[model samples]
Target: MATFAELPDSVLLEVFSYLPVRDRIRISRVCHRWKRLVDDRWLWRHVDLTVYTMRPKVMWHLLRRYMATRLYSLRMGGYLFSGSKAPQLSSALMRALGQKCPNLQRLCLHVADLTTVPIASLPRTLKTLELHSCEISMLWLRKEQDCSVLPLLECIVLDRVPAFQDEHLQGLTRFRALRSLVLGGTYRVTETGLDAGLQELSYLQRLEVLGCTLSADSTLLAVSRHLRDVRKLRLTVRGLSAPGLAVLEGMPALESLCLLGPLVTPEMPSPEEILASCLAMPKLRVLELQGLGWEGQEPEKLLSRGLPHCMVIVRACPKESMDWWM
Candidate 1:
């Protein structure tokens, strides 16, 4: 067997690829050639620092040493930061990401304070962005003058952001290339802003809006008018009426739809109307109803009878709590 020193550069780099960023950084100190080989661009293509909450200083050290232009995907759990210091660290990190990792495509951040993070520092090539339980100060998202930042982004997931509102949704309209968007815990967005914002995203193919108070008819009308190509849709509706269910006929391309709310009662839309709407959808194959307790007879059986081509599922929510945390 060959010794560590006798191993070829390709063999050494391949071994380092499987190691965590911390371990790779540690092993890079073993020898002069190992230190040089560890900096190879291919070795840093995909970096996930989410396993542990990273320290700011250590994150800075790694950014300076290992993050490179070849890095494609990065997921960093939020740093435990507070007050004035947090913005400085975020700005510095974003600047390094902009300056070094020009090819970064997907970025995920959890529990981050996004008050001072600059949109300009985000790489122009980025295609996907996900922010979970992040603190985004009220209207801070709409304050940016550059509306087209991340213009190429195709997907965005904003979860558990209570401060996100109509103006923030309006700001997102600039991403004309957006194909898929998910919004959870955004309770402040209403029909007016939701309609205006979605009208601009004509390319949207998939959309999910939960914990918002929009009526079902208005939401479906907007989707039918603006997002004609939407193949999948999921939204929590309020005060869904019988005639409102007929709006599904306008969306011929929809393949999957999920309706969610407290419960589907006799007070809500009638089962016959819903069944008729299900049969009208041309390409629909999957229909999911969650947290909706049917009144007399379950809508599932009625829909299955009308739509032999569609799969109908009805589920009671695991818990009554709509808490968006975690």
Candidate 2:
């Protein structure tokens, strides 16, 4: 039988890769050979610092020591209670990331304020950026940079961000390479902003707009006319009539659609009419309806009227508390 110490360095490194960051750090103190293997740059390619409550100085030291150039995907920020001082620390860490990790492709910041960070300080190589419940300033979006800020960005998710508004959408038109966008719980963006901003992004393919007050006539009409290449769309319909929902008929390439929120009001069209309008689409493949308030109607019977080629799902909202997206 072979002893553990006689194993090759590659084998040891593979084992260390499966361990969490904290566990790897602890085991790095076991021996000189283990420490060397644990500190290898390949093992630090994806760094997640959200698990610990680290001070600014300690985070800086860790970045400088371990995450200089090999980092590819980074997820930071769990400082929810550190209100006033969080932005400064986040800015420092972001600056360090821009300087050290030029190859980073994906970055997710949860509850980190990004007001003070300069736009130029973000890595130009990033393809996906997810800002969950972070405070952002209008200046951060509109600030002029040297053409390198978010030039190659493909996907951006702004989840429950209060500061995101129509101006931010207008500012995003500079990124012509953007393909996928999610505006969940951004209540400030209106139909005019959505229409004007979306018309400029001719390359956008996937879109999701939830927890916002949007109209099917103005907003969905713009989506139908402008986003001709869209493949998947998720939205919340508040008070759209059956005819208003017909705006989706203009999207020739739409494949999957998700409709959420209270879509069955007395003033709007009936569930049967809405389902008929959806089935009229040429290429629609998947349809999901959730959280609809049809108190007296049988939604299953309404949806079962001969959509043999398409997949349809009709369900009520769950009684238990769950994630907003669910």
Among these predictions, the greatest TM-score belongs to 2
lDDT string for model 1 (1-326, tens) is: 99989999999889888888889988888888998988898899889887766667888777777787778899876653544444233766777787788888898887787766766666677899888777775644573556668878899998877678888887776676788999887768888988888877777899987665676778888888888889999877566776777777857689998888673445576657777777788899998877776654457777788888989887775463245322
Cα shift from native, residue 260, model 2 (Å): 2.2
Model 1: colliding residue pairs = none
For residues 1-326, what per-residue lDDT tens digits would candidate 2 score against the true structure? 87769999988888888887778889989999988987899999888877766777877777788877888898887576676555244555677787888888899888876766766677788899988888776676652534457898899999888888887887777675789999887888988888888887767899988766676456678788789999888877666667777878747888888777654465575667767777777888888877776664476566656566678777775552124444
The lowest-lDDT stretch of 10 consecutive residues in candidate 2 is 317-326
Q: Model 1, residue 5: what's the lDDT?
A: 90
Runs in model 1 deviating more than 4 A are 1-47, 64-70, 79-89, 137-144, 261-265, 269-272, 294-305, 311-326
